[model samples]
Target: MSALAPAVPRRTPLDSFAGTWHLTRFMLRRDRVRLTVWTVSLLALYAYFVTALSALYPAAEDRQGRAALMEQPASIFLGGPNYGLDDYTIGAMFANEMTLWMIGLLGVMNMFEVVRNTRAEEESGRAEMVRSGAVGRHAAVAASLLTVVFANVVFALLGSALLITAGGLAVADTFALSTAIAVTGLVFAAVALVTSQLTTHGRGATGLGLAVLGFAVLVRGIGDLQAEPGEHGTWLSWLSPIAWAQQMRAYVDLRWWPLALSVVAILVLLALGAFLASKRDFDGALLTGGSGRAEAPSMLSNPLAMSWRQQRIALFWWFLGTFVMFGATGTYLGEGVEDMVDDIAGSNPEAAKMFGDDPLTGFLAIMILYAALAAAGYAIATTLRAKNEEADGRLDITLAKPVSRGRWFAAHLAVVAFGAFVLTMISGALALWAGALVNGEVELATFLKGGAAFLPAVAVFMALTAALYAWVPKITPVVWALFAFTAITGMFGPLFDLPDAVAGISPIWWVGRYPQEPIEPSHMIGLSVVAAVLLVAAFVGFRRRDITS
Candidate 1:
């Protein structure tokens, strides 16, 4: 052992995170716009929610009445376990009604942010290049988590300040609620990290993360429905990080223990993710994908077929999710529509307006609106797949073949249009069928017409996304911003007392509330014409633009 083996230093655990700060800085720089948008949106939504709640229920009696309505299974499923309902204050209402939704939104945002930086970077070969530098094996994951945590911290601080100053909520309760929201988001970010280690594809990771979220929602909803007011939900609720956030009881009791659960979970998940990441080869996953066919099927011969093949799995997930959610809502509605309507109307007239005089039809119309929004989301995602393919250089390879750019682009749009229509129809039919199963009477045709009424709006959104993709691929994400604006306006416009001119800017607002009011043929014809123009513009722009890659 010649002087030889002067022992080389063994790597310590901290060595794995050696370049974490550098990568974190890089990630922040890369996602500055995205992170800023999420932050600002959350803050604005929180402000709006606080302001709306204060204005809508100015008195203690009003708050208590609103709390009574929240006892409904549908309300509990959408909101949270009925905490502080007996003495419901504005702060308590915010904690009970809005906490879960905010955390859920944050969960989605965190999932995408983590998956984008981790698995997506790996898929794009960027991680490999980064790791070739002085970066440690775990630096990328650490960086992603740090960046997300940083964003959450900023949100929590700003949110706490906003609640205190704007809503005049209790300082302690506001801090507790804001902290819980931030930690809950971190929990999901950790979940996404684990998922990213489980699959090679970014879509697979994102899907897995979302599936976990869906499960959490389902479990938490069911658990909350099983429990009475002022009580902790069933054990199933305890299993969800979302429930953990709510269990903090920010306004009622303000317990800090629930947050400990989330912290422990984050640690465990982060550890597991790191272990998996280290054990696998770069660009590999612990759960390796199975081998595919040695030969391409005849279906792969066309651009349209290829597009369907790429999108069918995601479409299936969407359909399944929509079915489960609406089916559950319908089943709950079966309890007593009249009573439910009376409770809702008695509590909040603004919300009651969404359901017209014919309560059942009006309720179904609102569901149809939700279904249409879901379809629009699916359409946007499907349309953006073209942009993704182009950015990844796959579209160039496909175009290098005999296929024309216009044909290839058109195939994606066709899939988007058809998929959106089917999703909307499925949501309406399933909701009606499920409701009829329990309630004993629902006309399928009425719901179908309600679904059909939104087809034009769906088409417009799809066309708009396609046009953006064709003309300015860099700004394709603006479509999502538009989608968000439309959703907020459609859902809260009535409550906010927004003017018709303001609300009319949303394409969904253009569609008549079906079953409640007859869908106007003129609205349909005009929307179709607008969609046609946008599609024409998209086709023309695609023909002229350079392939991004």
Candidate 2:
């Protein structure tokens, strides 16, 4: 006690990280429901697709035949690169089908930080307290990365187990398939991790991540297309991280090194992000936050404008999805339904009328169906804004003002309308652009024509979402559930011999199968009537509701 004690160091790793364990526990608690849902949903999708692939391409010859048929520009863009489709290569089928779509969706979902460290923390001011503790600059970042890594590991293990349990495929193929999907998930996890670091806000993080995700898809698609023509586009695909992860092909021609690339890239990004945090002041960003307006802008003067401002980014994504689907990847991929019609016509030519040869009508119908689905995504997202407002407490204070309940409802409706309108154009436009790009055909009318066809069908999703939000406010996530069911069914249902009753349940089914070009007057009539009825009901029901806990 008499001896002078050595001067204590100003900081230690444990002091700075003491709250990390607590933060990890908190992150787990918040994300359990979300993690469960994401894992289960992915499992269901995995099972359905594995079954579909096993059945549809049972032999090496079948795989080759399918690959040959995938030559259509729409098919190339949407279904992705198929490596000759050998039975051993069934893993590639899953890779081509699920990798980009799942990764992009999951990447965006994980990056939003809607659960832990960002928006939710901001909403509750939990972040301020956590920082006030002995936490270091990198604790939050480390905690968030740890959470995402845990989620990806869980997802991988769960997926591997389900693929094994799902049965039918060869054991080797099953492992390969699961590995490919897991790698895809891991790639997205890395992407989302880096994205969360760069933005000051959750939405911004999501936007940055999705933009990368979208670019990954486009790069892969373009690279694949170029490679087929014996060009350097294959080099382009090689440049993309997604293409690298996918080339592993688990069961066939496995390239293990790409996983290393993802790991290295993710680690480097994490280090950079952590280093930035160490240098910056606490609660600060490497990039400065933009100054908020001194007074509210005139554009945000109304409830509708406020709604639009909040969701404009979401609208942009929906628009992109719609247009891309329409052009070549999405709506155009729907064109693949026509590929089997030759076999169908040979067996029963009558079935070919809607599902028939002469791909023009079938292709158009596919385009419309895609257009509707893309539009629905936007509609559901736009309608969900109401829930977000109330949950965030924005609605409570706004309603306390002179704004009438009806005006408040009406303002959000206006955003839905504008977003929905742009969404329609986007669906048509992206499809047109992709198709034109690959085909080297850029006539203005042709582009306009391609984009124009999807407008009416997409309007239906907006109306349907509005209806759901109106009738049931608390259960807002139901729209996503509905979309999931419809999407899974639309994708693999036909291959599994799904019952008409099951298929009919999706409003997307009523929009008519597209790229088949079966645009019946009755289909348009049905779509319009359904949209009108739902919208009227939503407005009516919303008008009668009161606020709740």
Tens digits of per-residue lDDT for model 1 on 1-549?
Answer: 557657788999898778999999999998999999999999999998898788767777667767766776667886767678889999989988788778878988999999999999999999999988988888899899999999999999999999998899999889999999899989989999999999999999999998998888888988888886557888888988899889888888888899999999999999898888879888998889679889899879799999888888888888887877677666544435666565656666665665556655666667777888999999998898888888899999998999998888888888878789878888655565575467666667777877888889899999999999889888888888889888877766666668888777788888967777888899899999999999999999999989966
Q: Model 1, residue 105: what's the lDDT?
A: 81
The lDDT per prediction is: 0.84, 0.62
By TM-score, the best candidate is 1
* lDDT, model 1, position 33: 94
lDDT of model 2 at position 241: 66
List TM-scores for all candidates, in order: 0.92, 0.82
Q: Output the lDDT of residue 259, model 1.
A: 93
